[model samples]
Target chain A: MQPLVLYVLDLAADGAFERCVRRVEARDAVLSVTDLSATRGDGVFETVVVIDGTPQALEEHLDRFARSAALLDLPEPRRDLWRHAVLTAAADLGALRPRAAIKFVLSRGDEAGDGAGTGWALGFAPSAPPAAPPAPIDVVLLDRGYRHDVAQTSPWLLQGAKTLSYAVNMAALREARRRGAQDVVFVSSDGFVLEGPTSTLIARIDGAYVTPPTDLGILPGTTQADVFAGLRAWGEQVATRRLSVPDLLGADAVWLCSSTRGAAAVRSIDGTPFTVDDALTARLRDHLDARKK
Target chain B: MQPLVLYVLDLAADGAFERCVRRVEARDAVLSVTDLSATRGDGVFETVVVIDGTPQALEEHLDRFARSAALLDLPEPRRDLWRHAVLTAAADLGALRPRAAIKFVLSRGDEAGDGAGTGWALGFAPSAPPAAPPAPIDVVLLDRGYRHDVAQTSPWLLQGAKTLSYAVNMAALREARRRGAQDVVFVSSDGFVLEGPTSTLIARIDGAYVTPPTDLGILPGTTQADVFAGLRAWGEQVATRRLSVPDLLGADAVWLCSSTRGAAAVRSIDGTPFTVDDALTARLRDHLDARKK
Candidate 1:
């Protein structure tokens, strides 16, 4: 497989998209540069879709990013500056490709570049192009073995931060890879099904679209939120609640949605294969497409 | 306050000290470069003391680093190479200053990094001296919020590895800072006092030295091990068992030992202040100095 071209950006560049590797100093001590992972993992970010020179669900993505930031106890995002940065990056990659994937990493910055403060870092990368939209993803359940209060707002140092403390997430992915699958679903020790590595799970059960409640501490995915809201305008009943792994496995249909992939249906659950229902997937894609325009 | 000079070196050089801040692109994907905090934090490292142009306890520190790596299921360290690197860095710095600090970081490489599938980074740095060792750290009781299996070694990693997953340690430091102190002693939720942020607690009670056994999953500090062994040679009955925070607070003298500062007596508990006897402290210091030589 060929390596994909990713567009990397810094959060400080105002309305400018440049292609280069630069290290932004964290506002803590010189120690901050060496110990980025030691600080609280408390910022929020988004992985977005760029297709046909258009960024899918830009507004919804930013909205959730803001929410994640708030949850992690970060300061209000400068939207005008953020919007310009995203758009500029998209525009710069315009002539090169019709479709690409972009990752927006927002980390907390130290209020000042001392060495003991906090700040956020925003990163953009172009990697794998969006998979065939509406393709179902394989779902595997793994016990994450820990629980956190998803209710109380995370400390500004912790809540919605896209921290570099991603060891557990990487462990799950490694487990999934070992199982001959591309992605895995995190199940709480108590059996609640949460989200994916970089995707959100949306289930169609009893003829309604249901997802795990955002208050459960799952990242509010920009792409999933847009798809859910768009489906609701067509009078589709969308509900948010706690879901167990068994609940997901027994669902009528399950789809993993994200800003880049848009939506991928669950092809199997714990090795049990499921038939992909084309009609429901087509409708969801159509609704998302309409919203994108 | 004086600016501190640290020596930086590569683990690959096997202790051949290169100039400080020298960058080497040895691995295609520097586990140090990739974001893999999501796997396991199972690596071991050491912070060494350099005084009068000599690395204090160089041999014993390497022995502990190697032992820690083995205990955490890491490859056997290249001791000759690693030591040479430290000595080289020491020699370079010896020319610039009479006293310095060097830290040895040994992590699992990404492919070999931690038992997980990411790379690891190992190196040394010159560090600043501590603030007169902490007049003995003011101890605090904390709950062991996570279930760590210290007894059985699963492929699962434990607290022994010096991986970048040091958020909890820093948080403990922050908590200590909140209480107007410089350090903290970790008490398991079950009431067992484990260790400190970057030091190990050794209590001198009834003329015997006691530290928690590594069977509890604490990183065996190179400096702590040497102190204990030294005390035992002088006929001090050093024992390792489950000791509570209260047990620590009420000891004759409680000391926090590390590679950097040999020993700092704990001067207070939660609210009770303890007296530090200079003769006892001097004896321990003399023992440590003789062992290093």
Candidate 2:
């Protein structure tokens, strides 16, 4: 069946440009598109760096995706089959324009049946974080639509998976817009600053870099891990620690790191502006570039 | 567009039932179907009791659905619109067995949106838990999955929605089956017995019944609340308190309350068999029946 609607999107909210085709599935269509907003969010996703028409970190991303699937007790996707699919999708976008992002989603196919025919879809989402941390990205704190804290026993399923239950992410982004910010940072109801809706947060405090502890259940970001490792090797004191908004607002520097955006320095928090250390920002950017190449 | 395949079944793991469906989406001339599994393990779900073919608690269910949606940071299903759709779907069921079970799933609909129109399928799976909890049912104490204690935060996104992310629930059920039991009970990593995968747990201790506090982030069971209120009016002491497996195993009686099952008494814990108190079960069941009518 031809999809009900298909459109080429010149740009997605993430600022990454891409062409997308949408198909609407009937309520009872067994083999059609399933609406993702209704079920418990259970799925794993991978974002790979596409540079010069090749996917970097494909293997690592796949590994993390599988780990996420296992963590959520989801049936692991066939490695070779999915890898081939990923390669095909990336290759489809021939002649990459210097840098691009590839997103892979592996979800439980459909909830209608016994959850068989595990569904898999791939979409090319805009992946680049601001080439340079937005000269000053505005951020707001709001009630997270879901729990981002890694330390609590959550009743809702799909805690850490790159699940499609991303309505909250979009909502948070919308909230950011409402608050006159390009993005929003999440704080636990208890007052501890967690992470951004989409990126792992790193802050410079007293000349040291810090992130939330991984055991807190934050998504173990590939980019965050790499940056932490690089910073540590460079004799920089980097660590993961609990942080509050006061801590972040008072930090020497703040940045958001993700697969697409290596590291974006935060310019303001709650409308309070901060100075971006040009030397430190350039060093982080250079580190990301060197690693990418 | 006619859905290629349709099914209605309860969200329980059946070792003997292996049914697969090729869920198809109708798009003009393009018919695409994805295979789905038959497990309801990791997702959160809501069971709205329908009366006269019209779903009662539509707004409440939507409210809970939104709360559940917020827990997972799920995308908004447009409360009124989705509520209407759910009512319509329940209405289509045509008063199946009077107290109809209307379940809406918000899982990662499909995970292959590599822009080929994959990822996320909203599905309405209608089914029932066992007609009733068996009197004097057996219980087991098992630790099969990661203990999501308060010390650890969920690593994934939207850790608190009622999506089809139910892998652990399935595991607990399987564990019960392995021990010759019909239903499984979960305890928190901290040894505090949580609710059953599908039911709210209550125990009568020293002539007073108590349930876990909702602040622990457990699913708020509608039936449990009704029963609690009813039991209280009758001068029975009912309170919300923290309970452990040992406490439940030693209580006068333990019960599992859900939308369809109403209430059922546990006869034993782990491998130790306990006697079913028909008197108490009947009392609670009668109270529920009175409230339902």
Candidate 3:
């Protein structure tokens, strides 16, 4: 596969939309030490999956990106510019591999700069090819340390925003590994199932695909939305509702959905195993892989 | 004053302790977009004040830095190497300015690399000279969205450690600004006074200087420790105990203590004015500025 593709978007204080993006070598240092992203993690980001030279759910990802920026009180990202950058990077990387991931970031610029923001998009193929039928993952439930209503009660906590300040998320993942699990599904302090550190929780309870409501201080999942749409098209019931740990434990099947990785079936949680439906897992993978936009 | 000074520490997996740091221009881009600090905020950091070519509380800052690293499960920082880098940057900046701030960061390295970490130190003088007797700040109390016991209940929440994932802290500062306040003091959801977004809370209650216990999931403030030392030397009572919002409102005086800025008195809380103890504030400032280590 070709090496990673990188582009730094020269964001302007006033909108200057055309021809400002510059392609750079991935190894080159493209961020200053004083950039707020590096120091404070004061930024927002989105990851889009590329399939056969097309960025899947591009507009959805951009909408969520802007929403996250608004939550952080950052300048509204110019959508057309970000779209061009994502599509261009996706095409370049997709030409090298059928499936790739592209992550775009908009930061609150350098602390020493003129208060203008910084932006960039980077695309790369996964080191290993996607596992057919999607490999099943083991997850441990971890306490997210916030009540379910935190987003509504406290906006400054930034719970619903997809921010670059993911050190806690990363630490939770590490905690999962330390517990001999592959991933984590964070549980709210009040006993509701929140989303994963980087993915959305989708559980098949009572033969209906249900994900947690976004109002519970969690991200609105882009891939989970697509999966729900596909499930509905197939005449299956889909929903957004609160799921507790017991609900998860009683589910027939469960998966963690995300942009690049699509859906990875959760095989067990906290050492409790659930019967894996291989046929349905394959069907979900097919549904995700079939996306063209 | 001279321009900013920066040094990128060449960290080795095996710990090469001698002479591996290199200075670079502060304007140069020195971090990769894929570095965990930029992407995930998966890092730890410390800031120390420099005065007259000496880094203040150097050992204390390094101790806290190592503590933060251990909390994140990062490799234990080589203190000697970090000491060398911090002192070198401090001396360079201190030569130009009587007082300057030096921040050092250690990040989990590039996602695509060999798992080696990345590190750098940047030093710069504040834009304006210190306000005489220190400026008083108005603060609004914001909900931090976690119970005070979270640090003990959930280490994964990363409370007590000063990680680079400060997006929520930055957001709180912005919220404070929107509310017409100069700063924020984040209170726990349980109604106990926690700390400031970037500083430690010190309240003079009932003739004693008190700060919240570190067990409450807040940073062990280096500057707060220095302030306590000074208070004890003056035969004033100092203690670490739990303080609630009501206790804070009824306090004789309150201050936010940090490394570079020392102690900035909180002139008011939620617009309720506090009596500024000018003599004590000046003494605290003098005590902080008098550090020679």
Window of ten residues with lowest summed lDDT in model 2 chain B: B31-40
Model 3: per-residue Cα lDDT over B43-146, one tens digit each: 99998888888999999999999999999999999889999999888889877787888899999988887788999998987766767766799999999999
**Cα RMSD (Å) between model 3 and the true structure?**
1.7
Q: How many clashing pairs does model 2 include?
A: 83
lDDT tens digits by residue: candidate 2, B74-185: 4544544455445555565444444455555443232322222112212222443344434467877653223434312532333334445454455456557767887867
Top-DockQ structure, candidate number: 3
Residue pair clashes in candidate 3: A56-A293, A57-A293
Q: Interface RMSD, candidate 1? A: 8.6
Writing each residue's lDDT as its tens digit, candidate 1 over B24-120 gives 3321222232233212233456667666557888887787777766655556777775676667556655676665656555544332122432222
Rank by DockQ (best first):
3, 1, 2
Candidate 1, A143-232: lDDT as tens digits: 543343423422312323344445445545656777777787776435677788667888887888888876555677666887788788
For candidate 2, the per-residue lDDT at A2 reads 14
TM-score of chain B of 2: 0.72
Provide interface RMSD per model, one decimal.
8.6, 9.9, 2.5
Error of 2 at B39 (Å): 19
lDDT of 2 at A280: 71
Candidate 1's error at B25, in angstroms?
14
Say which prediction, candidate 1 or candidate 3, comes out ahead on TM-score. 3
